[model samples]
Target chain A: MLTKRIIPCLDIHERRVTKGVRFKNNIDLGDPVEMATRYYEEGCDELVFYDITASSERRPIDLEMVREVARAIRIPFAVGGGITSLDDMSAVLLAGAEKVSINTPAVLNPELIEEGARRFGAQCIVLGMDPVRSDNPACPSGYEITIRGFREYTGIDALEWARRAESMGAGEIVVNSVDADGTRAGFELNITRLIAENTGIPVVASGGAGNPRHLAEVFIKAGADAAIVAGMIHTGEYSIAQIKNELHQAGIPVRRHW
Target chain B: MTAIIDYGAGNLTSVKLALQTLGVDALITSDPDRIMAAERIIFPGVGAAGAAMESLRKLGLQEILHTVTSRGTPFLGICLGTQIIFQHSAEDGGVDCLGLLQGQVIRFAPADRRDKVPQMGWNAVSFVREHPVLKGIADGTEFYFVHSYYPVPDDDAAIIGQTGYAGVDFAAVTGRENIAATQFHPEKSGRAGLQLLENFLRWKP
Candidate 1:
């Protein structure tokens, strides 16, 4: 049986591990490789890294960081934030990332999803979405896709786009609710369940996990296969072991390391 | 030297790095001769079986791989590598594979198993029969896996380890003589994965 995945997400800005509220006002954490090693040591099931270095230059992803992190940890991880082309995807996978996630570029040109899946296997591509609250009749999920780090609304219905992305060959989807993000109220269960219920691919629910109980709720109620956690673990609120132990006590099948 | 076959597949570097971390200096090469000359060969895969076979044929490595494995050289195949070593696959609409073992790859039927198709996370691998690759690796230790198709060996003797996905048992590891392959990627499986690689490094068979 496959266990419920508990992921610890981290941000990489200017080649260093950084912390921020949702997506802004950041402070350096430390060396990404060191942090990754510590998390892997503590039995983090997986890691989701976001290169939050906003740039207009069309540069490549940080291959050096990918290699360093890969050398440090043995678990699978997904890297995102400037993956604009298939060549970039290949480079990231070659640098030892198990998967490459596309956000804005995937939305701008949806064909890239099909092509990336066609080139690298669908298992290597993750569809990341930052959605905000919406109640438009056209949007069934009542959530709209937001880009540019949650500043711009695309008017695209979150659930509809999620179905389309699955049909387009996305092996997994990461739903990070902008409204629920950094609020610590918990994941937007409605939106997360909406996406998870409709798509056959694994759904990773990101954002607003205040504690381990929040994760248990996301996995049990929302039907998320994995949780993209940050703030709680980032702020030393709970270690990966403590969180997994709590989930285990809740009768959730989480991998036990210690 | 152990050479990891790179047929334009993902995780070639991770396999090499895992080998390095295990203190075994392995080489990542697509050349046929280097692969044939290596003391041990690790074929790693992360894509479709048909395309991987195409890449192998394009580089003229299919025959060399067959020759080396049949000639009693230790061979380790991961994921698609293990699937391609079988006779046929249902992926890409029924494609023929290397036929090194008596098995066929089939997609996980969710209705039958009631589990996710990809099964993309840590799962317990129980040893059916002990082999050197299982050295120091505890039984039922979870290993990372990311795939939709699981190999169903025609002959039960070749299957060494089995993993249950939603109550359906599938061959997660198989071996016959010198050829040993795992459906899981040991490179990406953390400490336990490293231990398997270390055992493979010293595997006499």
Candidate 2:
């Protein structure tokens, strides 16, 4: 069976795994490479490294740091933040990331999705979307897309944007709810089910996973292929093994080697 | 020397790094000479199967790979590299492939898409029979995979392992004589991935 993925996302800020509530109030955890290695040892299914401040800082992703993390761990890893072009995507892949996640640039220039998939293959291109509720019912999803680190709303309907991304060849979509991000309340399931049910591509529900129960709910009820758990893992509230164990008992299939 | 064939695909560097993690050095090459000269060969591919086959032909590697494997030189293919060893693939709409192995690659049907087409994630595999690659790896050990299409080998003799996805079982690993290939990306499968690669280093098939 295709097991549900328990990915520990490392929000990188200047080479450190930084934490913030709802994408603010930055707090440094430690060296990213070291943290990533620890998570890999804990048996996390995958790792996601987001250069949280890259777009606002106006710089490229830290390739040297990416190389260090890639070398330290052996699992498939995805890198996002400040990935604006094909050159950037290729560089990250060469540095050893299995996939590259694009949020800001993908929305601003949707061609990046098509071009990245064309050059690297669809499986290597991941579309990262930040969605928040919008007023317009005609918006299809009733949620507008946000970019530039969730500071700017693109006014693009989240559901339509996801379908467009898949058409343009995004292999996976990470539907991150800006409203639920860092809130620890639970995932925005309505939107999650809305997007996952709508797109043929696998959907990864991001944000608002405070515990194992939330993870189970997302996988079993929300129809998410994977759930990105950040704050809880970083805060040492639950190890990857513990989370997977809880899920396994809950009848959610997860990889168990350790 | 072990040769890691790079045919304009994705992340060949990471495969080299995985070998390094196993304390094994591999020569990353697109050069047909290096590949032919190596004692062992590892062909890693990611992307469209048609394009992968095209790159192998362009680099003059298709013939060399077939020749080497037939001569009993230990060879391993990963992901798309594994699929290209088959007769045909439905990926780019029934593209003809290297035909080095007796198999046809086909897409998981729309009914199977309930789990998503690519079926990307970690799933356990039970080996059909023990081989050198299964040395330290236990049955049901998890391996990472990312693919839309999977190969269906004509002969059951080539089948070495199987994995079930969305109520459908597929050949996860296939091997015969000197050649072994996996539908999953063992290079990125963490410890189990590296262990399989390490076993490949000492495999004398």
Candidate 3:
């Protein structure tokens, strides 16, 4: 049976793994390779690396860091941030990254997603969405989406954007909630469920994971295909084996190693 | 030495790294001579079938692939490479494929609404038939897969493994003669995936 995945996301800036409060105020963690290897041994299903500085730097993904992490683990890894064109996707794929993620770029130019799916295959292209709750005069739920590390609001509805991404050939959608990120309260189940219900693509819920129960809650209540975690795993609050076991106990159908 | 065909498709780096991890000397090239001279050939692709075929034609690799595969050199196709072995793909209005096997590639349309189209992430596979390529592989082992289209073989005997999606068992692994292909990206599939690659390396055509 297909099971929900527990992914660990590593944010890379200047070749170092870092974690922050709501995608800002970065604090360096450690070497990416070491961190990635640790997660693999801990039984992580997959890994995601976001080059947080790529957009501002105006450069391609950091292939060196990508190579380091790729060399460290055998599990599937995805690289995102500042991916603007097919050439960028090709470069990341050539760097041993299994998948290339597109966020602001895909939102800005929807053709990037289409061309990416055309050139690199749909399965290899992931659309990353950062949604914030906006209570403005227009959007009551604060459903406006943001790009480039929550720096710019695209004024696009999150659910509508997810649907558009699927139509644009996005194979998977990573819904990162700005409100829930770094809060560690839990995943925004309502938002995740909305995206999952609206799109046929696999929805990976990112942000606001605190513990194993949180993982189970998201998988069961939110109807997410996968849950992305970073701080919980990085801080040693939970292990992958423990999370999978808990999910299994809760009837989540996770794959066991033994 | 293994020649990894490089016609501007994605995921060649990981495949090459996997081969190297197994201590096999692997070279990424589009040259027909280099590919023909190798002990084994690996065709790794991650992109549209039509565009990939176009690139292969542009680089004159279609003939090279045909020539090498005919000579009984071990060939392994991964992901999109696997899809291209069929007669045609429904991805881009029926694009012609390499036709190494008798099959047509079609998008996975799950009857269940819960089942996604791409079927991204890891899923378990059950072996339906025994073959050297899957020698040490066990039934009910999970492998990572990310694709929208799956191969529907004309000859059912070509299928070695199958996975259920929305209650329909789909081909996970397909083979004929010296050629074998997997819908999953073995290079990214962890220990089981590595073991499968090892089996391919040791497989006798």
Chain A only: TM-score per candidate = 0.97, 0.98, 0.95
User: What DockQ does each prediction reach against the true complex?
Assistant: 0.64, 0.80, 0.56
Off by over 4 Å in 1: A55-59, B112-114
Clashing pairs in 3: A121-B47, A133-A142, A134-A142
- Cα lDDT listed for each candidate: 0.87, 0.89, 0.85
Question: Which pairs clash in model 2?
Answer: none
**Best TM-score among the predictions, by candidate number:** 2
Give the TM-score of each candidate: 0.96, 0.98, 0.91
- lDDT of model number 1: 0.87
Which window of ten consecutive residues has the lowest lDDT sum in model 3 chain A? A135-144
Instruction: Please give, for every candidate in the order listed, the TM-score of chain B alone compared with the true chain B.
Output: 0.97, 0.97, 0.96
Q: Write candidate 2's Cα lDDT for A1-258 as tens digits.
A: 889999889999887888899777899899888888999998998899999888888998999998998889888899999999999999999999989999989988999999999998888899999999888765766899988878897768999999999999999999999999999889989899988888899999998999999999988778999999998888888888889999999998899994
What digit string (tens of lDDT, one per residue) describes model 1 on residues A89-194? 9888888898988888888999989999988878989999998898777777789998878878898999999999999999999999998887877988989998
Off by over 4 Å in 3: A24-26, A54-61, A84-87, A107-111, A140-142, A151-154
Candidate 3 on B79-166: residue-level lDDT in tens? 9999998889999888999999898998987888678877777888889888777777678888888788899999999898998876
Report residue A60 deviation for candidate 1 (angstroms).
Answer: 3.7
Cand. 2: chain B TM-score: 0.97
